[model samples]
Target chain A: MSSCGVLVVAGTHGNEVNAPWLLQQWQANPDLIDAAGLAVQKVIGNPEALRRRCRYVDRDLNRCFLPEQLEQGASGLEFQRAGELLRLHGPSGEQPCAVAIDLHSTTAAMGNSLVVYGRRPADLALAALVQGALGLPIYLHEADAQQTGFLVESWPCGLVIEVGPVPQGLLNAGVVEQTRLGLESCLRALYQVRQELARLPDALVVHRHLGSRDLPKAENGEPQALVHPELQGRDWQNIASTQAMFRAADGTDRCEAWVGGEIPVFVNEAAYAEKSIAFSLTRREVWPVEPNWLLALKQLLAAA
Target chain B: MSSCGVLVVAGTHGNEVNAPWLLQQWQANPDLIDAAGLAVQKVIGNPEALRRRCRYVDRDLNRCFLPEQLEQGASGLEFQRAGELLRLHGPSGEQPCAVAIDLHSTTAAMGNSLVVYGRRPADLALAALVQGALGLPIYLHEADAQQTGFLVESWPCGLVIEVGPVPQGLLNAGVVEQTRLGLESCLRALYQVRQELARLPDALVVHRHLGSRDLPKAENGEPQALVHPELQGRDWQNIASTQAMFRAADGTDRCEAWVGGEIPVFVNEAAYAEKSIAFSLTRREVWPVEPNWLLALKQLLAAA
Candidate 1:
C-alpha cells in the first residue's frame, strides 16, 4: 500500500488559533490520537500566518486552493503555500494524503459543524459517520460562485470541521476541548472504516447551503448595516420573514429579513465581514445515506 | 473655560467594532446621549484601521500618543493620525477636549470595567461615580514600561471604557448594548459633576495593576500553552496558587499558578497575546474617595 493516511490540517486561517494549539498538544502526546493505529498526519496549513497571529499573509489560504488559482502559480504568500501543500500532500504527491480534514474556528455561533463542499460520496460518508456519532449539523456548501476554492475539495475524501463562537487569535478552552472530541469522532470513523466496522446511520442530517448576503453597504462600500442585534449569534436557527436581520448603526432596519423556513449560518462571522457576507442561509434536511457513500469510504480507507 | 467637552473616542483598536458601531448610532440619534447637555464629541480614533477591519496600519493607534512618539511623527499612518487628532482635539488644540473617554472591547471576560492610567484625582472621581452607580470594576494601570503610550493619556482627563467577553471584529448584541450603557454612565457622570449633583459612593472599588504574565512559550516565542480551561474566563476573580493558569495544547498543565489573592484581568485577551500578556494581575481594593477627587471632577466637567 502507498504511504496514505488521514491528514489533519490546522491553521488554515491563522487567526483561528485553538485547533493549532490542540494539534501541538496532540504532537507531544501521541496517545491523544486514539484512532486504533490509523496513520494520522497533522500539519499547520499556514505556518507564516500562524507565526504572525493573523488570518493570512497575502490572501486567505483556504480560498487559494482552487485549480485555476493554483495553475496560475503567481507569487503570493498563500498562493505559493497552496502549491507547496499540494506538491507534498496532493493525491499524486510522494506522501499522499488519503483523506484531509481541515480544522477551523469561527466567530459565528456554529457549534461543531461539518462543511462538505459537495455531495461527494466519500466526503458524505465521513461526514455521516461523525454526524451520526456527534450529532453535528453538516453544511452542504455548493454552487456558490463567491465562495469556491475550499481546501477539502482538492482531496478525494475530505471535509471541514468548523467549530466556534471562539474569537480569532484567542483560545477558548471549551471550544478547543469540544473540537478535539469532534475530531476524535472523525478519527474513530476513519479507523472503523479501515477495520470494516463502520456503521454510518441510515439518515444523514444536512443544512443545504443557500447563497449568502453581505451587510448592506453605502455608495463607498462601507457597511451601512450590521447583522441585526436580534439575529446576532442566532446561527443554525430557523428565522421568520419578519425577523430583523440587518440594522444600521442608528438601530434602523436597513435590510430585508431572511425568508421564513430558512436557517441562518455563519451569522456575523468575523472573517466573512471582510468578504461582506453577514450570513449564509440554509435549509435543513434528513437524507438517507446512499450505498455509493460507504463504497467510496471503504475504497478510500482500504487505500490507507 | 477652554473649548472643552467629553471627547468620546471609538475605533481606537479598530477591531473593537461594537463601540464604533454604537458611536455611529449615537451620532445619528443624539437623544441616546441622555447626558443633560454634556457636549460629547464622538470620533473614530483610527478611521483607517476601522475601514480595514483590522487593528492598525503601522503601530497600534492607541499606543502612538506618547510625547516622544508624537514629536518624532516624521511619517506613518497612525503616527500622522495621532498628530492630526491632537491638532483637532488636544488640550492645546482648536477643539480642546477636557475628558476623553476612549471606547474599547477585548476577547477577555473583563465584563464592563474602567482603566485609569494612573491615580489622577479626575480619573478616580470619574471612576468612583461610575463604579458607585454601576458597580463596575476599575483597573488602575500604572508604572508599566512595557505598556506605555495610551490615547487617553494625551488628554488632561480621560479613561478607557473597556467592555468585553466579546470577540475582536465580531459584534455581540449583549456586549454592544451593555457598553453603550457604560458610555451613558460616563456622560451622566460628567453632567452630574457639571451641575454639582454628583454624589460618588463613599468607597471606590479598584483592581490595582500589579504586573502581567504570558502563556508558556517556546524558544521562538510561539506560545506552548493557552490560558488554562478553568482560568480562561475568570477575569477580575482571584486565582489560587494551585490554579492551572495555563495548559499546553495536549491538555497538559505547564505554567506557574497565580499566587492567590491576585485577581486576573484580560484573561486570554487576543490583543495582549501579541504583547505577551496573557493576563495582568491586580489586587482588589475598596478605598475611600478623597475630597479632592470630586473637586477635580468638578473642574474637568465645569470646563467641558
Candidate 2:
C-alpha cells in the first residue's frame, strides 16, 4: 500500500440496506461527503442477496471470511463471493486496503457501536479514535471463535460499525444519516491520523465480551417466555442478579438473573432469534490508554 | 350468535411475534387477563408462518379475506388459510366470532392505532368505545379497496389493534405490554357494550385515507431519496405543501409536497419500502355521531 487507504464494505449481509444506501447516496454526490485525505474503496458486499431482499442466497457472507475457507475454495455461493472479496479487498490484493471498515445495521437496540474483533493495538487505536470522536461504546467481542469469520478479519487493520434499531432490508432516514456521519467521522479520523495529528488517551473503556443468553424455548422449540418488561428496550445497561430477564408463559415463573454485574448488548435483537440467541452480555473493562496511537498504528498497518 | 363474545386474533402475519406471544401468555394464565363479563377466544392466525419465523409462506394472510377470494376457492397457501380462518372465526362459522379484533405490529413509528375498515354502524360504535377507552388514534382507512382484504373484514363488528415501531419476528417487552393493554381496553369496551352501559360521543375524528407516495427509485429499483430530515420521525403531523417530503440523492432536488392539509401516516415505515411505498397520506374527517350508538349497534350486530 503506497501510503494509506481504506476499504469500506457494506451489506455484508444482504438484508442490511442502510450502509450500502449511504455509500450509494454519497457516491452519487461525491462532493457531499468529505474524505479529505483518504483513498476510499466502497463495495457493496453481496449484490445478489440485496437484490433478493433476503439475508443470503446460500450461506451468510460475513461468516464466509475465514482464511482457510477462502483458501480451500468452498462451493457455496457465499464462499465463492468470499474469494472474490478476498481478491478485491483482502490484504493480499495488488493494491491492498490499508484498513477495512465494514458497515452493518441491526434489529437490536445497539445504537451506533464500534465492534473490535480483538485487542490488536492498531484496531484498538483506530476504534479509540472513532470512539473518542463519537463517544460510542466499543464492543470488544473476542471470545466467540465460532463467530470469528467476520469480513473485517481479512484485513490487518479493521473494525465494524454496527448501528440500529433499523430492521433488515429497511431504510430509516435517521439510520442512513447516522451511517453517513459515522463514515465521515471515520474518514476525518483517517485524515488526522495520516497528518500525524491523532492521539489516543492512553486508556479507554470497552465492553468486553462475556457470552450470549438464549431466549427460553420449549422442548418443541417454541419460545416459552417474553422478554421481561423491565429489561425491554434497556440495551447497554448494567443489570444485577435480582433483575428479571424473561416472563414465563405461565406468568407465575419469571426468569431472573443467575449472574449479575454484566451489561447486556444486542438485547432482544430480531436477527439473533433465528440463531436462538437472545442477547450477548459484556462487562466493561478499562485499560490504560496509549498516546499517539493512531499515527503509530497507521504506520504499522501500512508496512504490514 | 352468542350474546356476548369476542375473538382476539394475533400473528395475522407470522413475523409479528409480540401479539401472539401476548395471547400465549394470556392463555397460559387466563386468570391474568381481565375479561370478567366476556367470553374470549384467542387464536394465533398463521402458525406455519410463525413457526418458520417469516411474514408469510405463500402470501400475506391478512390480505386473503376478500369475499370474492373466499367464494372463488383460491388455491394459495394464505387463501386456503383464509378459508380455514373464515370457518373458524369468520362471520359464517359454526361458532362465529361475535367481535373480531386482529392484533398487529408494524415496522413503523405508529405508536398505537385502531384501524376500522368501513363505517358500518356496529364497527364504528365498537371503535368509538375502544377509542374513548384508550384515547388512541382511530385510522379510518376505507379508500384502498384493493387493500381491503383485512382479517377484520370477516366479521360485522371488527377492527385491528395496530401497534409499532417493532420489527417482525421480534418481541419487544414494551410492545407486548402495550398490546396487552390495548387488548384489555378492547375487552373492557366489549364488556361495557355487553352490559348495555356503552356510550359514544355525538362526534368523532378520524384520519381518513388519501393515498400513498412511493420513495424515489433508481432505474434498477433502489430507493433514490431519503425521507426528508424535517419529516424523519414526525409521524401524524400535518405537512404544508412547502415542506420537503424526500431529499433526492443528488442533494440538489428536494421533493416537496404538491398537496397540503393532509396528515402523513406510517411515516418512514420499514415494511412499506419493499412495497414501493414511502409513506401514506391521510386527511382528517369529523363526522356526526348518534346518541346511544354502542347499545343500538350492539343490538344490530347481535341480530346480524
Candidate 3:
C-alpha cells in the first residue's frame, strides 16, 4: 500500500463553485490521480453556503480563521469540519510525504495561473513542475508582518490554483477543466519531486517587499489600463483607457502618460483602484529589510 | 480710509527669510496699529524653519498645501512656512470689508517685518495698520505656479512677509516675543469666502492603507492565510497567525479594517514594503480609496 498524500480544497462560497466542483471532478476521476501515482482526499469547504450558491451565510468563510479561534477549539462549521477531516486522516503511513492544494478564482480579468509561497526551495520546485505541466504563470509572494491568518501558511507545500472569474450561478467550464488539469499537474510534480524536482528553478529569494500602487487615472476620471510586468514576455493584453489621465496627487490635470512607456504592473487584488498599481518591484537591491523585520518590529513595539 | 481687511504675503524661504521674522514680531505688538477699531493683519507662518537653524534648506518651501504632505512636511522648511503664513493671509483677493494679514520669518530670523503687498482688502488692511508693528509674523507666498515657479495655492487675498532663519542665524528675541504674543494666540482662526479650503477636522479621520503580512507555519509546512474579501471594511486587524489569510487576486497579501477606526489612526503612512508594514490617513466618513483603499486591500489579500 502506498502512503497517501492529502489535498486541501476550499473556497466553496456559492459565488465561487468552480474550485469545489473542479476538485470533486478530479476526485471522481481516479485515473487523473492514479496517473500521477498519488492518493487524494477531497474535503468540501463551506458546504452550507456552497449549497445556497452564495458567498457566505453569516460572515465570509475566508475571514473566519484566527489563531485564538483555533486554540479555543473554535471554528466555523466548514473550517472545523475540514480541520477534523485532516486530523482524522493524517498522511498515510506508507507515503513518505504529503502535500495540500487550495483552489480559488479572481475577480480581475486575468489568465489562468497559480501563486506559490515565497522562495522555499521545495515550493519553488513544486511551482516549476506545475507551471511546466499546466503551462501557466506562477506568481511568488513573500509573506510579511501585515499579512496573517492564511490556510496555506499553516500547511506544507500548499499551492493556490487561481482560475479566472466564476460569476454567480454560472460555472466557468473552461476554468473547471483547467483546474482539473492543474491538479493533475500538481500530482505529477509531487510524484517527480524525489528525482528531477531537485533540478527545478532555484527559489528566488524576495527579501524586501516594495509596496504596490494602482494604475494612473485617465482625464475623464476612469481607471487607466494596466499590464503586469511578468506578462511582458507573454502575449498578454489589456483594455484601453476611456479618458485622459488626471493627476490625483497634486490635481495636475494632464494626459495619463506624461512619458510614453509600458503601463506599470498591477499588484494585489482590486487592480482597478489607484493604490494597487505597483510601479517598481523593489528587491534586496533597493530595500534590504529581512522578511522578519516587520514582524520583529511589531513584536518589539507590542512588548514595549 | 477703508480699513485694511485682508493681507497677502509670500517668499519666506530660508534663502529669503528677511521678511517673515520681522512680520511675526511686528504682528505681536498691540500698539503698532491705531487704537481705532479696525481689522488687523496677523503674523502668518513658519518661524522655526525660516529661522534657518536646522533641516530647512533641504526642504522645499512649496508643496506644503497638500494634506498628506502637510504632516510629513512639518519638520521641513516648507511646512512651517505654510502653516504659519496661510493662517494669516487667508486666501487671495481683497474683499470690500476684509483685511489680510501676511507675516513671515527669515533665514537669519532677523530683518524688519515688512508688508510687501496691500492691494486687496486683506493686504490693504495689513498695510494700513501693521507697517510698523512691534514684532510680527511675516507673510509672503504670492508667486504663481507657472510664473513664479512656487506653490501658492491660495489666491486673491494674499500677503508676503519675510523674517529670520537666514545666513545661519537663530530666532532673535524680538521675533520670538512677537510670534508668541502677536500671532500665536490672537490669530485663532482665518477664513476665506472665495475659495473653499479642504474641510478641517473636528475628529481625527484615521486612514489605514494596507501592506503585506507575516507568513505562518502550518502542520503540513504549507503557508496559509485568508483570501482577500472584495467588500469594503472586511479586513481584520492584529491577525496573529499567518496561516489564515489569503493571497490577493493580484498575488499580494490581503488586509482589512473599518474605514475609520483605531487601526487607520495608528498606522499613518501609505507606502509599505511588499512584505512590510505600511499605512495612511483619511477622514472617517470618506469611502475607502487611494493610498488607503489600495493599501488596505493589499494587506487584506496578503493576510486574509
Candidate 4:
C-alpha cells in the first residue's frame, strides 16, 4: 500500500487569511487530530502581508511562477517564501504518495467550492469524496497550459479549494474554522479512497457554469423580484453531453446550450449567471497524466 | 497644440539592469534639462529588487495590472513600487497630454529594437518617427484586453525598447557609455518627433521582416536552425492582402505567405532570436484615450 501524504497549501493569495488562520488553529488543537487519522503538511503560501490583512507586499504570489523569473530571482517575497516551503516539503525525486490542496477564495459572491484540476485518478477520487462530504459544488475547470504554475500543479494529484468569500465579520475565527473543516474533509476523503478503490470509480468529472447577480434596488421601491433556478439532484449526471443547457431563471424557457465536452467523459458548469455549478462523471480508465507543458515552459523560462 | 509629456519607465522587470541604471544616470546628468524642450518624468518600476541585481524580490511587476489585485493591495514588491510611481505620475482626474516609454531588454541575444502598442493614429506616427530615427524594426502587436494592466497600456501611447541584453560583465565605463548612447538616441528621436510631426507625411509605411541565426553544429554534426516567417508592410487601405512570408536559413524553399490585415503585430525576439524581423504601417489620426481599465477596476472594487 502506498503511504499517503497530504500537503495543505493555505493563503495562496496572501489576503485570503481564513485558510492560514484555520490551519494554525487546527495545529493548536490536538483533539482534532485524534478524530482524523491523517498526517498533513501545512504550508502558508504568503506570510509577510497576511499579518497586516493585506493581499501581498510585493506581487500576486499566484501568477509569478515562470522559470525565467525564478532564475532571475525576480519572484515576489511570497512566491520565494512559498518556493522555500515546496523545497522543504514537496515530493522528493523518489515520488512520494501525496496529494496537494491549494486554498483560495473568490472576490465574487460565490458559495463554497473546490476547483479540481489535473488528470490523475487519485486526485479525481479524492475530489469526489470531498464534494460528497462538504456538499459544496465541485467546479471542474480545465487547467489551461499557461495558468497552471502553482506548487500544487507540480504534484501528480492536486485540488484548489476556493472557500467562498472570507467572512470578514468574524475575522480570524471564521478563517480558522473554514480552513480546519476543509483540511479535515480532504483528509477524510483521501483516507476513504485509500481504503476503498474497488467501490469508487477511477475518475470524477465536473462541469461548471457562470451566472450574473441581481443588482441592488432603488430607495423608494422594493427590490425587483429575483428568482433563481432550482437545482434538483436528479438533474445531475455522471455521464452526459457537454452542451450547456440554458434555462430561464424560473424555468420558463429552454435556450441553446453552449459547446462543451471531452472525448471519453462529459463534464460542465451547470448553473447560470449569478451563480455557477459543475457536473461530474466517473470513468474507469484515462491516459497517464504528465507534467503540464505550459508550466514546464514557464519554469524553463524562469530558469533560463 | 497638446502639451506632450514623456514618462521614462525603468525597471519593468527587475533583472534588466540597463533600464533603471540608464534612467538613474540620466536623472543625475546635467544635460537632461527641461530647457532641452521636453517635460520628462523618470519612474522606477521595481526599486527593491533592482538594487539586488535580481529580476524581482516578490513578483514580476509587469504582470500585476489587474483591478482587483491592485485594489486589494495584493501585489509583489515590484508591483507596489510601480503602483506608487503610477499614482505619483499618472494623469489626474482630467486627461493629460503625455506619452510613456517603458524600458526593457531581451535575455536571449543582442538586438536593439522598439515596440509600439496601441490603436491610436498619433501613437502610430510617434512610433514611426522613433523607428525611423533609431534604425530599428517596428513590431506592431495588437493590444489584448487582458494585457491592459501594463502602465504603458494605462497611457494612451507608449513604447518599449529592447536596447540589448544586460551585459554579463561588470558596470564598466564602456557599458555605461553604450547605455548613455542608447538613452540619448531615444530622447533625440522623441524630441525630433515633437518638433517635426507637422512637416512629416500624413501616414508613414515601413516594410519589416524577421530572421533567425543558425547555431553551430552539435557534436553529432547536425546544424541547429531557427525557423520563423518574414512580415511585409503595406499601406493599410491599399494592401491587396496582409500576409506573412517566410524564407528559411538555407535560402532554398520559401514558405507560403499568410493574410495579415486582421492579425496583431508581434516580434518573436527583437535582438537575440537570431534573425527576427518586424513590419509595420503608421497612419496619423486622433483618438480618445482613457485610464487603464484594470486600474479603474481596482478603484471600483476598492469602493465596492
Candidate 5:
C-alpha cells in the first residue's frame, strides 16, 4: 500500500528546543538534511506550545494520540492541536503520512537513542537499522499503561529520536549536531530500504521498559526525597540493592528503595516531576531480528 | 541601630527550583540552615509562579521591583505578587526585613557566584566578605537600564546568591549544597559584622558589567546564530576577536562577530532569550574595599 511521505515532527513538547531549532534550520536550507531524494515533510508538532516555550499548553501532546482521545470533543489547546494534526497529517488525511519520526530532547542524561513504542515490525526494523548504523541504544518502551498515547503511534511506522542531558528550552551545540546526524542517518536508511538494499542486524539490543518510579512523596504530593547525587546523571546504569538511589531531606542517602539489577532511564528528568516520575526502570534485553520486520520496513519505505 | 530580621527569599523566578527546595527543608528543620542564632525569615518570592513551575506568571517577577511598578495598580500576576511580597517582607512591613538574600539558579554555566547590583556599600561589603571566605567570583551588575528591579535590591543590605549550570525546575546536589553554603557563609559574615569583628577584604575582585551581546536575529525576533561551540560553556573567560564565537546555520565558524577581551557571563541563559540577551560581556577588575563599606555593614547588622 502506498503512503503520503515521511513526516518529521519536531517540538512535540515545546520545551524541547534543540530539535525544533534544527527543524527550522532544515526548513530554511533543504540541503542541510541529506534526505537522498526521498519526500521528507518537516513539521512543528506543537507550534503554540513552542511559542510559549513550555512543555505543553494544557496536556502533553505526545500523550494525546490514544484512540479514546479523539472520541471526545477538544477542550484544551493540546487536545485541539492533536485533532488538527491528525486532520492534516494522519494516515488518511490530506497529507497522509506513511511514517513519523518525532524529534525530542530530554533533561535526563539519555544521550541519543531511539524510543520504539511496542514491538511493531516496521518500527523494530527501522530502530535496528539506526542502531546498527550509529551504534545507538534502543529503548523498547512497551507494557507501561501509565505512559501511553505517544504521538508516533498515529503513523503506520514511527519512532522517537530522543537526545539529551540538555536543559529544556535551551539550544546546545552538541544536542543540535547529534540530532542532525541521527535524523540524516534515519533518512539514508529509509532511502536504502526503498531500493531494497537495507541490511538488518542479526541481534537488536534494547532496554525494555518495565515500570516508572516517582520520588517518595508526602500526602500533599511534595517529594520527600530527591534522586541521590550518585544516581542523578547515571542513566542506563545497573544498580544493586546496596546502592543509594535517593537522598532524604536531611541529605542522608535513602537506599531502602533501590531496585536491584534494575536499570534506570530518564533519571531526574526535569519535566517528569509533573507526572511524579523521577525516573523509570528498565531491563536490558537482546533479541534476534525477525525477517518479517525488514519486509515491513521495505514496504513502508516504498510507500514513502 | 535596631533593624528587622534577615530575609532569605527563594523562588524569586519560580523556575529556579534548587534554592527553593533548600528553603523548604530549612523551614521544616530550622537547623538545616546555620543562621548562627540571628533571626532569618525565609520567604518564597513568587508562590503562584512556583506552583506552575514556571519562571514567572506575567512579567519576570525579578523585574517587578522598580519604583513605578508599585505606584501603579497591580495588574499582572507578578505585579500583584511583587506588591504582596513587599507588603509582607519589605523594609517597612510588619516583618521589616533587614537584609535580603534572593536565591537563584540559572541554565548558564555560571557556578556558584554572587551578583551585586550597583555599589551599595552594604551589598559590596557583604559580597566582599563572602568572597574572602568562599573565594567566589562576583559579578557587579550595574548601569544596565535594561536589567533592573532585582528582588534583593529592595533591602538595605542584600545581594543575590546565584548558582547555576543546572536546568530550571531541576534539583542537583551541587547547586543545593552551594546555595546552602553560600547562604550560611553570608549569615556567618553578618554575625561577625554584628559584633564588629568582620574583616572586609583588602581588595575585591569583580567582573564589572561592560555590555551584553545578542545572537544575530531577524526582524521577527528569531535568532539567526547560536552561541559558538567554543564559547557556549566558557562563561567568565576572556575571548579574543579572532576566536569563533558563533556558528552559522551551515556549521561554519562566525568569528567576525566576536568581541575581543569581552568576558561573557550568562552565556546561553534559557530565560534571557525572551529578552534577546544571548550572553552578557564583562570586564574583570580589582578594587580596594573602602572602609565606609565595612562601617555600613556593621551599622546594618549591629541591630540584627
Candidate 6:
C-alpha cells in the first residue's frame, strides 16, 4: 500500500493563532496524535506574519496559491511563502502528499465547521468522515470557484478545519481546545479509514454555499447599516427571506430582507469587514458518499 | 467658567460599529436626548476608516493623538483627522469644548465601564457622577504614560465610555442598547450637574490599572501559549495569581502563574492581540469622593 500520510498546516493567515498553538501542543506531546498513524508533515504557513502578530505582511497567503500567482514572480511575502510551500508539497514536489488539512479560525460566530472546496469524491468522503466523527456541519464552498485560491484546493484530498467567533490576533482557549478536539477527531477518522474500519453515513448533511451577503453601504462604500441585532450571534440557524438581514443607522427600516430561507455561516465576522462581506449564505443538502471505500481503495491502488 | 457643553464622539475605530450606529440613530431622532440639555457636537471619529469599514487606514487613530505626534507633522489619515478635530473642538481650538466623551467598543469581555486617563479632580468627579448614576464601574488607567494618545485627553473633563465583549465591525443590538443607555445616563448626569441636582456616593469602586499581560512567546516572538481555559471569558472577575494565566501549547504546565490577585479587564481582547496584550490587570480600589460637592459648587459657580 502507498504510504499513508497527511499534511497539516496552520497559521496560513498568521492572525489565527489558536491552530498553530494547538499544532505546537501536538508536537510537544506526541500522544495527542497517537491514534492517527499517518506520517504528519506539520507546517506553519506564515511564520513571518505570526512573529509580527498581524494578519499578513503583504497579501493573504491563503489567496496566493493559484498557479498563475506563483508563476508571476514573488509580488509579496504571501506569494513567496506560497511558492515555497507549493515547491515543498505540491503535486510536482518531491514529498507529493495527497491529503492535506488546513486549520483556520474565523472572527465570526461560526462555531466548529468543515469547509470543502467542491464535491470531489475523496474530499467528500473525507468531509463525511470528519462530519460523522465530530458532528461538525460541513460547509460546501462550490459556487465561487473563480475566486478560489484556498490552500486545501491544491491537494487531491484536502479540506479546511474552521473554528471560531474568536477575533484575529487573539486566542480563545475554548476555541483552541475545540480546534484541537476537531483536529484529533479528523485524524482519528482518517486513521479509521486507513485501517479499513471507517463507516460514514450514506447521506451526509452539508451546507452548500450560495453567495456572501455584504452589509448595506452608502455611495462612498462605508456601511450604511449593520447586521440586525437579532441576527448577530445566530450562525448556523436558518433565516427566512422575510427576516431582516440588516438594520439601517436610523434603526427604522431593515435592509436586505430577502424572500427565501437560507442559513448564514460566518455571521458578523470582524475580519470580513475589510472584505465587505457580512456573511455567506448556504442551502442545506444531503450528499451521498461511498464512506470507507475512499481511503482503503486509494491506498490499495497506490500500493499496486 | 466653561459653557458646560458635551462633545460626543463615536466610531473612533471603524470596526466598532454599534456605538456609531447608536449615535447615528440618536441624530436621526433628537428627542431621545431632550432631557440632557447640553450642546452636543456628535462627531464620528475616523470618518474615512468608517467609510471603508476598517480599523484605520494608516495607524490606529486612537494611538496617534500624542502631543508630540501631532506637532511632528501628519503621519497618515488619522494624524490629519486628529489635527482637524483638534482645530475644531480641542482645548486650543476655536470651539474649545471642555467635556468630551469618546465612545469605544472592545472585542473583549470588558462589560460596560468608564475609563479615566488619570486622577484628575474634574475627571474623577465626572466619573463618580456617572458611576453613581449609571452603576457602571470606572477603570483608572494610570500606568503606561508613553502609550497615552487617547482622544478624550484633549478636553478638561474628558473620559472614554467603553462597552463590549463584542467583536469589531459587527453591531450587537444588546450592546447597542447598552451603549445608548450608558450614553443617555452620562448625559443625564451631566445635565443634573448643570442643574445642581447631581448626587455622587462617598466611596466609588474603581479598577486601578496595573499592567497588561501578554501571551507567552517563544524566542521568535510567536505566541507559544493561549489564555488559560479557566480564564477565557472571566472578565471583571478576580483571578488569583496562583491561578493559571496561560496554558502552554504542550498543555503540561501553566505558563505565567503568580502569587497575587488581580481583576483583569480586556480579557482575551482580539484587537489587543496585535499589541501583544492578552489582558490588562487592575487592582480594585474604593475611591473616596466628596458627595454632591461637584454639582453644587460647579452649578453655584456657573450661576455666580
User: Could you say which candidate leads in lDDT?
Assistant: 5
Candidate 1 chain A minimal-lDDT segment of 10 residues: A249-258
Clashing pairs in 5: none
The alpha-carbon deviation from the true structure for residue A29 of candidate 2, after best TM-score superposition, in angstroms, is 2.1
Residue by residue across A222-300, what tens digits does model 5's lDDT show?
6777888888888888776787777865778776666666799999889888888888889889999999999998877
The candidate that wins on DockQ is: 5
DockQ, 0 to 1 scale, candidate 4? 0.01
Each model's total of backbone clashes: 1, 5, 166, 49, 0, 1
Model 6, A155-233: lDDT tens digits are: 7778898998886766777888778777788777777776777787777898988889888776767566678877887
Ranking by TM-score: 5, 1, 2, 6, 3, 4
lDDT of 1 at B8: 87
**For model 6, what is the error of residue A240's alpha carbon versus the real structure, in angstroms, after optimal superposition?**
6.3
lDDT of 5 by residue, B1-304 (tens): 2353898989988899988889888877887877877777888888888988899988998998886868787589888888887888788777887799999998898889999999999999999999999999999999999998888887888989889889998978778888999999999988888877789879999999988888887687666778888887888887877887678666877665555567889999999988988888898999999999999887776654
DockQ of 2: 0.44
Q: Give the C-alpha lDDT of model 1.
A: 0.84
What is each candidate's DockQ, to 2 decimals?
Answer: 0.50, 0.44, 0.01, 0.01, 0.60, 0.46
Tens digits of per-residue lDDT, candidate 3, B1-304, equal: 2233434342334423323434432444455333233344433244455443222354545445554555465665566565555444433323321333344443222244332331233333222223323333222223223223133335333333333321222222333344333332222222211112112222211222232232232465323322222221222232333322333212345443333332221121111111132222222222222233223222222221
User: What ranking of all candidate models by lDDT puts the best one first?
Assistant: 5, 1, 2, 6, 4, 3
In candidate 3, which residue ranges exceed 4 Å CA deviation? A10-13, A32-35, A58-68, A74-82, A85-97, A144-146, A166-169, A195-198, A202-209, A212-304, B1-304
Q: Rate the local accuracy (lDDT) of all candidates.
A: 0.84, 0.78, 0.39, 0.46, 0.85, 0.77
lDDT (tens digit, per residue) of candidate 1 on A101-218: 9999998999989999988999999999998898998899988888778888898899999998888988777788777888899988887887789998999989998889887776
Give the DockQ-based CAPRI class for model 4. Answer: incorrect
* Model 2 chain A weakest 10-residue run by lDDT: A249-258
Candidate 4 interface RMS:
30.6
Cα deviation at B153, candidate 3, in Å, is 54
lDDT by residue (B16-96, candidate 4, tens digit) is 655565565455554633224556677677776666544557766666655567778875675676557657665531323
Q: Docking quality tier of candidate 6?
A: acceptable
Q: Per-residue lDDT of B139-244 in model 2, one digit per residue for the tens?
A: 8888785576888877778888889888766777678777777888888877776666777766777888888888777898878887876776666777767887
Which residue pairs in model 1 clash with each other? A25-B250
